[model samples]
Target chain A: MDMIWQGIHDAFSLTIQRDPAIVKAAILTLQVSLSAVLLATAIGLPLGAIVGNKNFWGRNIIVIFFRTGMGIPTVFVGLICFAMFSRQGPLGQFQLLYSPQAIAIGEFLLALPIIFSMTQGAVSSLDRRVADTAQALGAGPIRKLVTLISEARIGVVLGIFTALARCLTELGIAVMVGGNIANRTRTLATATALETSRGEFARGIAMGIILLSMSLSFTLFLAILTRKKNSEVTR
Target chain B: MIDINQLHVSKAGKSICHVHRFHLDVGHRCWISGPNGSGKSTLLRVLANLEQPTSGSCRITAPAIDIVYLEQSPFLFKGGLRHNLSFGLKCRKVSRDVRLKRVEETIESFRLQSFLNQDLRTISGGECQRIALARALILEPQLLLLDEPFAELDLEYVELVNEIMSCRPTMTVLMTSPHRPPESWSFDHLTMAKHTP
Candidate 1:
């Protein structure tokens, strides 16, 4: 208990000092998470929409795999990503390993399932009547999809937020694939890990504080967006 | 201008719609009414070609390809009412000016001025249905199939809808309902007798 308290105390002091190292790490973390989220959205959104509404050979199987991927261990994903981006790997020509891009790539994989599966769930759970209604209105595939997705806006946001949270945390992939390179790949998660392993309790505690704050702020923003008028909570 | 033949549909090996033969003509105002779970909607679904029959064929005389189905529930897209109305126009490559004109007409017809900016889910069921009707009308469909559209409407609104339906141009309309047509309203009606199987 004292160790934890002392670590927190020291962490806050260092963080408050505006340590350039800590600031750089925080920026890197945000960059990686944001990039991962954008990439995952680019890949996952359309895939989820198409997969949710259409049926084809192995469609069920593909969905099952995506859902299963949602619960995948971060380290497992990290290892896979590392192998793919490693010097001897197929994508090694890009030499992305140990770079911030590598961390983004790893985080992208971690966030992909979160975004894709939730999006799929949202699109599937959309009111069947919406599609029927759109079709009856002579809306085509693109228009119908746009309408359906909009109706399921809350669900879509939840999916994106879920992916963002996952990307923002999760140290395993960043450490393994990104090598936690200082001022490059060192995210809050990586910093937390590094501080703890080095017996730097205060720094670890500070990272924890920052992570908690980030998470809370993000969730609060989302909650505010979701609240509608005449909602009981407002009353 | 719609022809359906030997339409047989079953789900989980249980029959749904099994019409030996039926043909509907152009400009025909047909009413399909039946008890709950009697597949009235299913029969309409088959006619609309939205759902495939287990084993049957449906041929059209002049191809009601430009037909529209007015759903009981309105489906809203991401933006405002204008966005939802203009969506079909965008798909069909209609110009912006034409789309705006159509959307404005629908807004007035549905009396949706007050609710135009609100989300679809936030509106009343009656309003949603009206929005659905507006969306279908803007398509200029030659054929309209409605599924229990007035189920959620008030008596006054129902009368109002009848007045509006009367103004529809030379178009084939097939509306299904559980209640008898309002006495003040007149139409060419048909009945799908209760299942004997």
Candidate 2:
């Protein structure tokens, strides 16, 4: 209990004093996670819309592939990225190994399947009349897409929130691909793991507290959003 | 401005609707009456290009004619009444000022001003129908297909809709209903044959 209280005290103090190492890790965590999520949303939204709504020759296959990808191990993704970005690998000339970009690439891959699958599910569950009405209203492809997205906004938001959560808490990808470089590639998850391994229990606990707080904030926001959505539907 | 010949719509190899011959002149109104399993809605949907015939073809003479269809239980996207009214216009790329002007006029005509700012999902079915009709009308569609649009409305709203339809001389309307439309409303009647098991 004393150690836990001491850890909580140190967390606030570190946060207030802006400890450079802790602050850098925290900032990098935000940077990598946000970038991954933004890219995932940008790519996943349209792709999900198309896959979810259209019936094409290979649509089922695509859906199956993405659904399978949802469960892909992050370490494998990290391994593949590391293999490609390593000094002697095919993409080695770019020298992306052990860098923030490499970490972002891994996170992006991790978040993409989640965003796509959830968005696809959301878009797929919409009433068929929504698209039919849009078509009858003379909506072009882009307009129809926008209308569909708006109608399924709750689902899309939930998808994004889930992706954000996945990216924020990811440890394997951050450690393996980011290499947990101090003040450069270290994320909160990776920092926590590193500190705990070095027997620095207080610092590790503090990092855990920060991560838990961030996730809790997101969970609360999602709960409110879901309540609003339910009320809208019921009304 | 539509033609259907030997039109047969089927689901899973089971024929749901069959129309031997049908034609509509420009500005004409078509009221289709049938029993529950007679495919009145399906026929209207096919006309509106919402469904495709299994083996036959339907051709619209005026391909450039803007078309809109309102289902019995109309779908209103997540937004205020005003937003739903302006959706079709926005899709057509109408200017914002023109959209607002047209929306205001529609609200006044439909007497929907009270619910203009309210969420559409919160409104009654009759109000939703009125909003759907108004939304479709604002597009100035040349062909308007309605599927049992008056099934849930009160007599007053039905009369208001009829009046609105009567005023649009250039628009061709197609509607389906279980009962015959009011005598005051002129329409070329088509009866769908009930599907055999």
Top candidate, metric DockQ: 2
- Chain A TM-scores, candidates in order: 0.91, 0.91
Runs of candidate 2 with Cα error greater than 4 angstroms are A216-235
Q: What TM-score, over all chains together, does every model reach?
A: 0.83, 0.92
For B1-197, candidate 1 gives per-residue lDDT tens digits of 77778877788877766767777778777778766666778877876767888898877654434777765555555456777677667766789898899889878876778766465557778777776666666776678888888888887767766777778656778889877786555556666654544
Chain B alone, candidate 1, TM-score of 0.88
Top model number, TM-score: 2
The digit string of per-residue lDDT tens for model 1 on A145-230 reads: 77666666777788898888888888889988988878877899998889888987788788878878888988998787776521
RMSD of 1: 3.9
lDDT string for model 2 (B1-197, tens) is 88888899999878899888899998999899888879888887887777889977787875532888888899888766777788888887889999999999998988887875466667888878888888988887888899998888899988887888788898998898877887878888998879784
What is the TM-score (0 to 1) of candidate 2? 0.92
